[model samples]
Target chain A: MNLLPTEEQQQIVDMVRGFLAASAPLERLRPDKFGQIGNPDAALWPKMAELGILGLGVPEEGGGLGLSAVEEALTYIEFGRALVSVGVLGATLGAHLAARTMPDIAAAIMAGTSAVGLATPRGAVAGDDGIFSGEFHLIEANEADFIVLLTSDAIALFRREEFTGQSERLSMDSHMRLMRAALESGKPLSWSSVKDGIDHARANLLIAAYATGVAEAALAGAVDYAKVREQFGKPIGSFQAIKHKCADMAIAAEVASCQVSFASVILSKNSDESRFHALASRIVAVDAALKNGATGIQVHGAIGFTAEVEAHLFVKRAHLIDFIGGDQRVQKGQFIGADAVI
Target chain B: MNLDYTAEDEIFRAEAREWLDANIPREVRPPDGPGMREFDLGWQRKQFEGGWAGVSWPVEYGGRGLSLTHQLIWYEEYAKAGGPNAELLFVGCNHAAPTIMARGTEKQKSYHLPKILSGEVAWCQGFSEPNNGSDLGGLKCRAEIVGDELVVNGSKIWTSSAHLADWQELLVRTDPAAPKHKGISWLICDMQTPGIELRPILIMTAPGHHHFNQVFYTDVRIPLSNVVGEVNDGWNVAMSTLGFERGTAGMLENIRYGAVVERLVDMARQRLGASALENDDIGQRLAQLRAEVTAVRAMTYRIASRAAIAPPGSEASLARAFFSQLQQRIRRIALDIIGPDSIELPEDDPWIRPYLRTYSNTIAAGTSEIQRNIIGERVLGLPR
Candidate 1:
């Protein structure tokens, strides 16, 4: 059991971290006031695609990075830490998975000439032929070339231009743009009763990775603030309460990190226990993100809750991830059913 | 990032499994019958004979000297075999043995290690005091040095297995003039030593199951050599013991609880039927529980993998915290499924007793709140 990341994996993480630090620094992101997915600067997407991030999970034959889910998850974690757009993750993962079985479409997505977004919650059914019609707040819906409408029965690929109307931009998270769309009894690329299971697993894995990133970012921010922000003639971090809160955040982030990394490894190895690991990673990651984000805000005090502070961005992203893949209740149900089967 | 067992590790697992299957007698497993002491002793001896005891300890110390990964595999198989809970020998096997390996003198190792491995002796922790539950440094248990002997006069509370244990891995204040944390000493005291009194503290949750005792040491005398480390350096020793205690073994134990929860799921299915599972709400709840169990299992493996590669640090605290809360959640879910029947106290009711027994998990290994504090400070690098 090689539990530690390979040298190659570490290099990948370091490269991504360095890239995100330079290209998507918090300072640069702050002015946009949009979180990771909403409205990225016009220049960022193409650069990211050039860096092979958009193709992080795509197969080699599909003109992509050909990395495993574990690698993809880690890349997204960096995205999360940078508070980069959810659109990137959605587009990348949707394309990568699609490419594994649907080479042509995957090739389109990997080339940055096409983008796909998940338009349905895992396990949620909207209509026949895998045409998901339930409520979905699309992150970067306006920019996508196509939408992978995930329904309970199947996953339908929809061409963005086929729709008559345009998606509206929302203000809740400026970085992540939201849209509303309808699928009119569309034909599925593939249909299977187990699609819900696949979606559930994939969604959990993505959210878990995202949460890990957010929690880590929150820790970094809180730790930095504690060291530099002084109160009563000492660094705020010197105070017991502040220290404890920071410690809790660190613990949560560490736990979530280990869980996410482990789940990624499990997925790569194709372990029978992958489903369990994925679900567990999601559960821990969601809780960690929520707690770390809240504690981060608490440690930052008034400054954290302000719109200008990046702390709120972490909190917002955490909440968004929690709902996007499915809530704790939904994840827990998947966990229970899997447990029963095992 | 591979989780598959290496070929060597797979062979090791098979060998371990075969050994356990051939050696562990069915009649000795816990819950098969009462006598936990006999059951634990028997299992430990069986493992010792099979060269499976102390799988991670050095060979010189009567261990297999295997990699921690192999040890983890052994534990996974052991748990899978429905083996008896090793709670009775936990202190000896997990903490005391490791503490001795880390800080014990040569003589201490030669004498204690073999005995511990052979299951000739059992150990219990004597750290907590009536006044210092969470604040362990403030313990009032005093041990005065006089010549070559130490006169120990103090009391330890919540000493689990004290009644059955043969030795006590203890901490006591040795210097009143020094600060609370700096003045203590760690000593291995024989439970049979004179002036050592073990009063079984019958827990309300587990009637007749004497898992804890209040041991009052009144002028208990022991050779000064009994001290594991330097005088007034007990705090560090105690910390090391506590730290090593929260490792893959603990994770395995927690995951075993998940197995129990899995059994509860099976029971629920058999009793509640497919119709109950068909309901969206019920299906969702089961799915969530299934997911959490999977998560815990994954987290446990992650921890195991980390421990296998390096000395466990804050990550262990994270796992402990997560597992404790998850176990409690599992219990709550089980109770929910059982409904009002959970409250019923029929003598033969398995769910009722386990329901009561579950409360002890979070409390004993360190309270959930303390774990949170540890995670908050040590793992998270928070201010405290």
Candidate 2:
């Protein structure tokens, strides 16, 4: 019946929040250098690895701290608030999966000896046997020793240098770097076809959890701004118009958080309910991130739309997630299919 | 975070389902037809007689006194059983009864609680006025204290179920000179009282379904003892009512509707051939609808999970608004899939009017715009 995080979980949250506050403040991630690939804070990746966050969800036997998805999700929530980069989410989940299936590689990832990036169907090459070769955008690819390439059919790991790639720097979201890799039969360290029913369900749940964290952070930052920023004679938060928007954002964030948490628990328990919870969480989390991000921009007025504020970072990240692992349209078909089975 | 029912709760659910299956007659079920108020009322009474009413109310108040989980299970079963939408007694069961249980004097509880539970007396809400819908504090409905009776002279619009309701949980200004929010009183007004007139207002959606009414009071005299709480402190009472009005039950309703949307999508797929379902743009639209429905289901469960652990407050508002939007989206998608055939059906067509009736959902409880404002201010800590 408890919805609040456990005392231990709260301690972990405080630690993560503090770590991000000091090491990867939003200001550091701003895209200042024109034509530069993502934010050049490649140094921070090792710091996170040192914090053991990359292995947050991996089993202790697999050379990592074995926390449940719920605890890992809280870590990502703080990550969202810090506006560090999308790499945090990708690296953590990828490390978790890799550790579960490939222990040796997982140990390397946890020890900061290896870094991984996530590439979905929309972004890079995807196919059987982890044989993926294409321009993988936002690869953190330059820094990662390996990349976790996700396709509609399978998830596989690839050596970063095994494929020739070009990095195209973009103006939006300086905190993230984009790369395009070209490969002719790139070597696959490991590849397993995502089962028709099982893997997609798990992937969807993980993606939803990540999106929920992002939206929550965006919401908290916007609310903090509204409460302090003043217009006319009072704090902007005192105005009903602004208050209502914040209220809606808060509501969305709360619902999304609840759904993600529920899904995590279901997964941990290995309950039959996981499929329903996973689908529901993805649907709700994506909607919340989209709507909450838009509302965040609106509340920030002109500044939120500009590159100077970190609000746009949240917005850009939301757009990226919106299409990842199949957009709302594709996700809907899966939901209907699940419903029929139920 | 876990949504699995406890063993006891699961047993209770089975008992409830069996009881409802045996007691609720097949003939009494709302026909496969358009929404009808009279039919809804008959079904509500049937639920009352079967002891399936007020699953959330305490046993002392003639309810099952079950935990919220049990209540949710009851609702889920009721919806699955194809039970009638209990729209007729919604205000009584959802709002007024809870308010009375919380704040009513012993006498008020003794006289009203049993009748409300027994389906002997229906109730309607009297909160919104012509000028003060969202701005509830600015309500000008006046009630002057006179001798032993309170003389009420004001009007309330959008009062759902007033025409047929036996009682109105009315809010009126007791002290005109006091601040707008202060000096208001919450009174239980007998609908048959002198100088009371209920004008049935036809909300634009369904032509014959009179779900809303305009209630006018011209010096209607009610006993001073009818006040639910302390005099000049009705605002507190109203706030308490509004609090319960926004909780797990609302979320349950949304989840139920989400299930209905799931069924609709399924029906569309089965009846329409695969090519019709997949080839046309309807497939994309249905897919989006599925996503929206899933979102609504997830958000509702999220609220339910929170409320399962604690009393839901501002958080419920988010789920409420999200569900409302999702409902509208589902309705639109349903119409789009049904295409022109939806409108071309006769008025008696089972789905058309219900589809049209959903237009009132956002406007009825609280406008979607109001919901957005609440989300921004209360949840987001934004400016008013």
Candidate 3:
């Protein structure tokens, strides 16, 4: 069981990294001052579609790259590193959901003619019969025609206006703007059970992969800052305290990335243990992301608290992704067995 | 990345599983002392006789010469079958033999490798002097060039099993005038040499049992030919084989640690009943430990998978540090699970022993601090 990326996988990572590097550089997150974020990388849908990133997991017959979850995960990590809008994730999952059962919706989403925003139910409970009317937390909701509604058991798609509500003007992450939407009388345009719909296992794998990127990005940011940002007549990195913290960050990110990659490979095989690995990947990756994010900001000193550095962006993105994707506690309950096996 | 097993890999795994199922010693290893040494050596000899010794060593050195993947399979199978611990033989087979193979002269290899693989002799490391633990280069152990041999002086501490060891992979200050790091020499010092003394130091975990000794050399003599590499160049010679231990330990024992977590889970279940995981504190900690150990396995696998593409690096330190810390965590969890059973009626509690032993995990090999230094400087490329 090799964990090394195949040559083709390497090429895919390079391609995604290259696109993200050019499109949504970390410099964009380096705003002038506190409370001011740089212009969020506009979800340039057409370009993403042209690059076949929006519908990465859908099959060729569904007008996608026909790639497995491994490729999709590798690509999503780049998006995470870029702190790209969760709209990309919403669109990808939305398109994947459509590809499984609804070709027309898939085509529209994949072609960039239509977009999907992810709506995580926030006490926005829907009945078992699929009727919805409550407060829903929204991600990339303002720019989307469709919304992928996340219930505990399933994901339902609806027109954005169908869930009419006021936006939370000040969200933690401005790019993936967190909002509260009140849905009044909504029936799903399309929906599926989380198990069969978007394949929850694959979903967790992708999200974990994204978080790993954030964790890694934080490590890199901290290390880079430690290298040049001097204190006490030497680079702060030379200090054991800073050095050890950075080292721990590196280890955390490394462990997170390894598990993410492993879970992706397991999902690729359609293993019975896929859910197990996915849950584990999520737990470890999120832990790393959060830990590294906090540590990264600390390494940047006072500037990290300000938007003068991109440290805050990674942590925000990590939290935002984690909010939509299951948190560690939720996943732990689902997949944690007393008699654990790997 | 593909985790699909090749047909050959499956066959290899099956072979390992079958052999280990039959041959893994039924007797538990003795805790320490001569009997413990004999038990360990006997087990190694059994594996050697069964054609399973040195699973990754080359054929020329009397090993199976299995691929890294296959060696991992063997390790997993061995651990799964509840194989006896490879304690006394550890330094000989994993550390000394590999070093001899890589850096030793033809005579050294022919003299030592066969006996090590055949489990006829035990080896111990003497790099750490009383003064030089983490700072191994700052060692004060001295060796003077005499007629045809070197006269060794000073003492070595934490030389595990020096009282029992046949030979030692010793490091001495061969060129005192040279720099601290530059003047060292790596020698295969015979433990039976005259003027050498061993004072077994009782360790904390096992009462009345000792694996460590403080060895004094008033004027121990060692043959010049016993030096593995050039005098004053032994630091490099010694260093060449370090990452190997880290890599091998992480890969081979990760599966066992995973099982250890499972055992902890089972212990938690027995104590808390079916809803063991429903208990907030105990349950969450166990679950988190599982995740951490799984990560270690994944990280270990990543290192192995990348071995073919790139040489192993400071990444090994990350795994080492993580794994060592995990050991402490798991043991802590195990203690919490056992609770008063550990202190109430003194039974041979498996978990408590390891728990006490694990306190030394972060301290041994290199301190967690040293590992971080390596990671920050070497892997992360931070300033020295």
Candidate 4:
């Protein structure tokens, strides 16, 4: 029942971390020649596909890395550390969505040939006549060939052409592009039916794993800056004020990280408690990321506030990941009748 | 990444649940004092007689010697069964007994181990002095070696159960000329020794709760053999038991914390009426408490997963500080939920006592500040 990553799992995390560092460093978040924050990494799709990053959790028999949600979750933490595009999540979950029914599309999504954008469905409804209607908020989806939309209890994949309208809007988080689509379902939408409560838990826990990574990264950055940053002729870390904040950041990150492991393991086991854990883990991880990201900025004094420093990127990504399916506030209500007895 | 329990672990869990269901005391633990002590010891004695006590102790010491996972299961079941808190046995079983097992002489182990495991004796800690509570290394209680025995003088305050304890794990400054931290000696002191006097202190808690005392020692004598380790090296011996204690402390209590949060949510829902879910203050706070408590549970399991629940390193401070603060937060949230109902302690309401008692969460064991220092200097390699 050990929650620590195994040696093999450590290697996988290292491999993903190494891949992100080399291919897409934090420097990429820097505004480019046109002052644009991020450009579509069209080439990364095929490369990640070759590396099996897209379908890591899909069974090997179904053309994936032959891992479980635990491995996939660990990989997403590295993704969070790198501040990689949220579309990576889109592509990953998209592969999972397509695996059972559209095996061909699943292979394409996994192969990285098809870019799948993860979207949040608002006011979404599926009618008895087999029509799905919702205004979808697309996340990092401009370059996506396919968009994945989540209804309350199930998931559905849609072609970019299937949307009635698509538009780009400036978002609070520049690292991940936000778009909106008014979905007017044309044909009978095939809902790749998941387990009754699995869709929310699966997606929420993955998001939580990513948020945990951001929290950890924020703590690391704060600690490093505290050690080197000087104030009153001494490292700021020498002051109990800054040191205690760093300690608190460490605690928040620890609880958040452990919660991710917990939710991932329970989800992997298909436990009845997975939904409850999913909601709980998301709240803890998101809070950790938000708190650590803010405090990490404060720990750096002036430089942390600047866009050039990587500290604020965590704050941005934390919010973006937090609201991928739904913001944590709405998610909290789900626990109203949840297992107070158990 | 694996949380799969063996088939045997499940069976053990079922066994524990079944046993607890059959044997749990019908009465709630008293708030404090003799009744509380008697209730705790009697329950422990029952567990020991039933071969369920000392789940983490090695079999040679009359413990079940179950794996760490088994200890986790046993405690989880114990909490679920509403078992009385082991308030009287903490210093004995968790601190002194483990320290003895690690650093005690054969004779020390031979006598105290069975007595502690059997609930025949209660042990209280005498480490925190009147002014040296958090700065434990700078404690001023003095002990001088004299002809095959040690003479002790000085007072230890905030000693839980000291009034009822049969013996105490005492830390006194042996080599006053040496450095503050280096001069301390840890001794096993008989509570019945001459010149030992206890003054019970009424804490800011519910009425009738007198769980703390200040023990004054004037020329109290103890045989030198009672020292768990080398006389002057007691600082190391005293510190030896904290790792397991800090990392795993309040584990079973965390289950109670979860139940408390659940009960809070129930209370909030009833209080807030139909708009409870939309009520931002109480509703959201209760929801977050549930998540935070669940996170603590995960953190506990992660700590337990350490090989055989092995002594954690400095990282234990991180877990300790988090759990303690969360306890405070959960308690505070209850006060908010209870509103004016909390103005007076009701006989049947469970929230008020814990809410008041949790004030010590960040203060006791180690203050949150000291925990930060440990984290800053020891964990993050920051300068003092």
Best by lDDT: 4
Provide the TM-score of chain A alone for each candidate, in the order shown: 0.87, 0.85, 0.92, 0.92
Q: Write model 1 residue lDDT over B308-352, tens digit each, in one string.
A: 667777657766766666666666667777777777677666566
Error of 2 at B145 (Å): 2.5
Cα lDDT tens digits, model 1, A78-135, are 8888877666655665675566578777766666667665565534545644444444
Q: Which stretches of candidate 1 lie over 4 Å from their true place?
A: A31-38, A97-105, A121-137, A164-171, A188-200, A226-248, A270-276, A325-331, A339-342, B28-34, B206-209, B271-289
Shift in Å, residue A269, candidate 1? 3.6
Indicate which candidate wins on DockQ: 3
Q: TM-score of every model? A: 0.90, 0.89, 0.95, 0.96
Candidate models: Cα lDDT each? 0.73, 0.70, 0.81, 0.82
Clashes of each: 40, 33, 0, 0
lDDT of 3 by residue, A220-326 (tens): 99999999998889999999999999999998988888888888888877777777787788888888999999999999999989866788888887777776744
TM-score of 3: 0.95
Q: Candidate 3's C-alpha lDDT? A: 0.81
Residue range A1-342, candidate 4, lDDT tens digits? 789888999999989888888887877777652255555465677888888889898877667877877887898888778777778777877777667667888898899888888778655455334466778788778777888765435566677677767888788887567788886754422344434646557777888888888999999999998999888999999999999999999999999888898888888887888888877888899999999999999998888888778898889878777776667676676655466535
* Candidate 2 segments whose C-alpha is farther than 4 A from its true place: A1-4, A31-37, A45-47, A122-138, A161-171, A183-187, A196-200, A227-248, A271-276, A327-342, B28-50, B270-281, B308-310
Give the lDDT ranking, best first: 4, 3, 1, 2
Q: List DockQ, one per candidate, in order.
A: 0.48, 0.43, 0.69, 0.68
Docking quality tier of model 1: acceptable
List model 3 lDDT by residue over B1-384, tens digit each: 888779999988888888888887777777877888798888888889988887778998898877777787788788788886677887888788888898999999988999999989999989888878999889999999999899999999998888888999999999989989999999998888899988888888745467789999998999999999787999998888788777765576677888898888777778887464654578777778888888888887888787756657677888888889988998888768887766642555577777888888898778999999999999999999
How much lDDT does candidate 2 score? 0.70
